[model samples]
Target chain A: MTELNELTIAEARDRLRKGDVTSVELTDACLSAIEGAGALNAFVHNTPEIAREQAAAADARIAKGDAPAMCGIPLGIKDLFCTKGVPSQAASGILEGFTPEYESTVSQKLFDAGSVMLGKLNMDEFAMGSSNETSVYGNAVNPWRRGNDETALTPGGSSGGSAAAVAADLCLAATGTDTGGSIRQPAAFTGITGIKPTYGRCSRWGIVAFASSLDQAGPMTKSVRDAAIMLEAMCGHDPKDSTSADLAVPDFEAALTGDIRGKTIGIPREYRMDGMPEEIEALWQEGIAKMRDAGAKIVDISLPHTKYALPTYYVIAPAEASSNLARYDGVRYGHRAKLEAGDGITEMYEKTRAEGFGHEVQRRVMVGTYVLSAGFYDAYYNRARKVRALIKRDFEQVFADGVDAILTPATPSAAFGLGEMKNADPVQMYLNDVFTVTVNLAGLPGISVPGGMDRQGLPLGLQLIGKPWEEGELLNCAYALEQATGFVEKPGKWW
Target chain B: MSIDTETAAKVAKLARIRVEEDALPALAQEFNTILGFIEQLNEVDVDGIEPMTSVTPMRLPRRVDEVNDGDQQAKVLSNAPDAREGFFAVPKVVE
Candidate 1:
């Protein structure tokens, strides 16, 4: 029999509903699995007590036949989401020992829908960095090793822990926040499915902000159908988030008809970067063929401004980051360094922030401040915004040409070693976000589905960028692609 | 587009992050690399393109300016590093 911990959210839900298995049994199995997988460093804080409590409640609800789809499901939450009374740091020293008094909208919704909390997972500090190396809790190692090399690889970030946990079977599914490829890139690296919905599709009231305009939360799961179902449960309007869209939630699971009979999938010509690895290119072609086999018309499209997406994203994201992070002074909440007499308020703020933030967070904050400064505002910030508009227009033009979704390689390559990128130039590290950032820049819904593996046998993913507010149709297209590819290889647990 | 140590110091101070003197050179170099990457944006002509503030084409939803709920000071102060008498306590700013 498959271990209870190995079951997908959908499978566990079915078992719990039919009384074949109880929520408590599944929760205990996951707790033991997480306990044994400490070498992965996926979970930073374990709430076995809370997990049991929720599981018992869920079993009661299941017995009463009053449970939702996510009821009795155990999940790991990316440390970015504020779970009340839980240590809700975004894996940043500044937020160390800080527990939120209220639950973030997304996590609260998950709990309200009957999901059990297994623990808080690790992530990049302040949701920065492409690799999990910047996490205050240390790196969450990828379970997928490159054929006995033993060089622990990265699971991508700032949703690194979310991806690692779900991929390692530490949790059935995990909540992840993506501000410019945090969700999709990590999901690709870890060989799980992740979706970043259209901006405002989910409320972001309590998820720690990192580039407010770009940050959107979604689910990372073992399968595409699980992603669709969790995404529907995770999305809805909230009064606390002013930007949350006032729209009705759809039955995303029902929409996954697995038929793309009359759809048109666009292949953006610009995604074929110079010197892309042959494997990634081949995997993308395979994805295109799979979609074509599913009865979808494939058309070549042009997103002319694609080359400028990274730089445009950097300027805009960091500028917004600097402003959003200004609230983290040595004030009412979070870490505050000890101060000596006559060490005035300025010193207090400077010392607290400098001591609290990691190197990358401070670097981005400085860059953001510099770009938004008076002298460079029009040249950098404003110019990036205009370029962003052009980038959005590029997508708009393609969609207007009657394309249902656009297909591209999720990442340039497969899982890389943890310290492999440490000494390289930061710009090179930022290059990992190259293919994934454009979707965030446009605020469109995007999903990364595992397409195939590389020569070394590490997983690679294909991304689907969908029309704004058309996630249901987008998920169906992804389902068709997923069925045709049938790539469901889970990482062999070496941890 | 290159950044010097002096400009790097200025930017760090402006952002309220302390950078040691020895680190300024490295910071300046990193800034140069980032600026160089961003310079690629200059090649694209964005004439007549309005800046995209958001992807959703909706007006900011406004609510009536009235107190919906409040008075839970304990919950608000639960996470504070220092709290006193239903308020957050910070160092004195003025004599």
Candidate 2:
């Protein structure tokens, strides 16, 4: 029998609807796969009991014949999302034993659509690092290897576990949040598809806030069609989240016509950074060629402020993160350090935070506080915001000039070995967000589709960025590229 | 733009994160490196450019001044490490 764990969301939905397989069987296959693949360490919390319960419920819902596309489909939830009664640590030590009393709007919506939750996936500590090594549960290993090489590679973070789990066939799809390229970069590294929908498209009500302006939730899946299918269920206007866009949710899957005739794809010259790997450059050209062959007019554009995006992102994201993270003081919830006899309220707060946060999270919090301080606010935070406006204006000008989307390499390189940059300068790890941060800075929708592989047979992805609030149109462009590239290679399972 | 140990300690104090004596030097070094990289933003001419606080331009949504939902105080305190008398208990400040 074909392993039910390997079925795409779309394929599993078809099988579920036709009574070809029960959701219980599918869920069982996934549970066993997860158990057998413990070496990957993709899931920090495994809820097999809950999985069987939700799958049974889904099977009953499917029998009623009015089920949604996600009915009976098994999926993974990133630890960043608060699933009520489940540990949602955000992979940070501070939230060590915290169980949310309420559910995140995205995960709640997925559950309401009848998707079975396999468990909570691992991620960077408070979504702070580029590699999964920062995760409190330890690194989530990528299933791909360089021709029997025993070197363990990273599934790019802060959505590392989501990427690794989906790529390793541990689940059909998973949830991921992008503050600065968390979803797209990981998807590119793992040879899967991930999309960061336009900001406010999805409600941030219960998802742990990290750079509130840039954090948007999206899907990590096996194919572009699966992303379209899962994204429709994950987005909506939530009155609870004041920033949620008050727009009607459209059928995202319907937008994928697999046709991109007459669309204009912008190739930003500023993205062509010096010392960029030859494989990455060649893969970008191949993406442009494929888009042109599919009839998208490839035009070279200039985002002059591109050089400052990483710096701007580093400042603004940390500034917002500092403010958002202040809520974790030894207070009403989360981990609290042991207070000594002389320790007062201030000591309690300080010790709790110092012990709770990891090195990277602490570094960012300090950086954020420094920039937002009285003397440096205008020079650092305010200046970065103005540069952010210029970056947004650059995209607006191109869109106004009839460009439908932009194409670039999803990551600067392919999946790097774990611990490769663990002890390197912090700035070196921050460079991983080079290509993908601009979209978050602009609050635009972007997707990473597997275009081809590097020399070691690891997958490299090409990113397509679209105008704000045009995810449907963007999905269509990605669909055209997905069809043209024909990249259906899966990572040979070593885990 | 350089952050030495004194400035790093001040920033850590403001952020309410405790840095030990040994960790302060490392923290200061990391801060200086980050600040050095972010200094590149000064090269750009952003005169007269308004700071973008949000991507979409919309006033904050207003809710009618009426109680829409509540009454689950128990559920709210379920995750609380210290809850007493329907309120979150904290270290005493007024003693």
Candidate 3:
């Protein structure tokens, strides 16, 4: 039997509508679960007072018999999102004690829909690292262990906390932002579902900037249907964001008819990376087989520029980050370093940023500054931009040829132990995004669904990349794959 | 091209992040490894390809030139490190 806290968003919405459950009871269940699972370190900031108030309000809204699907549902908001009057640090020391006066556009949409805010979820500092190790709040441990091994594992990052919280049932669902696979990778590691919608699908107005062009906020939830339901609430055209697409938000949940009959699902040949784990390869074969069984045509497609995606991302994301992060110069808000005598504004800026940002963040800023420098701009930044065009064109070509969706392994392998890759070079860590970054580069929608388990009993996820602005179709394909695979395994409550 | 400690120092200064003199060699080496990895992009022949300014084909949305939000100076300055006289207080800029 599923606990109240463990209920998926779709199930909870129905139960609440039928008067089988109350929002306050659900909130208390999640709060108690969060309190008991302190070792996970997923939720860095708890707002029980606000949660209770919102629960009461959600209960009243439901009593009116006009509540939305997310009404009375509790969700953990990612720290990357600016929640009104809540500490909205991006897990960076630079943002210590900082709170937003207004809610992020996406979070406000969720609030307006009557979802109760649970608390702030932890993430990598400025969403830079692949593992949660770079977080100022430390690691958000994965709820799953490798066949009873006591050694803790990373729930992936920079949405590690969202993945962990959802997997551990700390919240029914959580919000996550993906720039180069932050949401999907962590979701893959923690055995949950995460979707990075098309870049302009969700408004980026009030969300803290990472890589502006690549960053997108999407739902991290227990199942694809929940993702579809929550994504409709999270996405819409917003005049607040200049990049926000002026498109209609479809009823994504209704689009899940579980019928991908005769739809073409492409298996991209280039995603078959060298030195990939045997289990991941096996999982990809399983996904393809399941899709074929679901009556979807499986075709071998090629995205030739796939190998160059990570390198291009490293260039563009950092260049934009350095420019975006320059605003945190110790004057307006957030951490301001203590200055010694004879220090001016320049010294202040230098000292504050050096002290405020973590090692990975600083390294990225330094690399960003270098690539955008006067001498290297054309060679590094501009060249990468042109290559990015190629990468985007590669997907456009495949989709233009009538490919509905593409399937690949979400991560090269399942979750790894904490600090396992700390000693490896940073590029070694970056390889984790090799499969998912291409979708971001092409500004396409991508969803990661837990497919099957590895030999160690750890879960592995299969990713489906869809054409631009076709998340509904993509989620349907993922839903069909989900039904075919029947992946209903939950992580043991070790935490 | 491999970055040296001197180049790394220059990059750090340019980024306005302080790196101790002893840390320069390590930072430079780290940059070297990353730059080496990034060098893979140089192999792609992108000579005539247009640099992608936007991923989705959309022109920048134009809005009427008007201030849509204002007032609440307290909220604006609420999170500032130092605020005085309804303005952000900064360290002295001129001698």
| Model 2 chain A: lowest-lDDT 10 consecutive positions | A330-339
Give one digit per residue, the lDDT tens place, for model 2 in A1-495: 558899999999998899999999999999999999999999999999889999999999999999999988899999999999999999998998899888999999999999999999999998888888888899999998876788999999999999999998999999999999999999999999999999999999899998999999999999999999999999999999999999988899999998888999999999999999999999999999999999889999998899999999999999999999999987778888888886788888899999999888988998999999999999999999999999999999999999999999999999999989967899999999999999999999999999999989899999999988899999999999999989988888777
Query: Model 2 segments beyond 4 Å from truth?
Result: none
Q: Per-candidate DockQ versus the true complex?
A: 0.78, 0.79, 0.91
User: Which number leads on TM-score?
Assistant: 3
Pairwise lDDT winner, candidates 2 and 3:
3
DockQ of 1: 0.78
| Candidate 3 C-alpha lDDT tens digits along A1-495 | 878999999999999999999999999999999999999999999999999999999999999999999999999999999998999999999999998999999999999999999999999989997788999999999999998789999999999999999999999999999999999999999889999999999999889998999999999999999999999999999998999999999899998999999999999999988999999999999999999999999999999999999999999999999999999899999999999998999999999999999999999988999999998999999999999999999999999999999999999989999999979999999999999999899999999999999999899999999989999999999999989988888888877
Query: Which candidate number has the best lDDT?
Result: 3
lDDT of each candidate versus the true structure: 0.92, 0.93, 0.94
Q: Which docking band does candidate 2 fall into? A: medium
lDDT for A336 in candidate 2 is 86
Pairs with steric clashes in candidate 1: none
Least accurate 10 contiguous residues by lDDT in model 3 chain B: B86-95
With candidate 2 superimposed using the best TM-score fit, by how many Å does residue B48's alpha carbon deviate from the native?
0.8
RMSD to the native, candidate 2? 1.1
TM-scores of the candidates in the order shown: 0.99, 0.98, 0.99
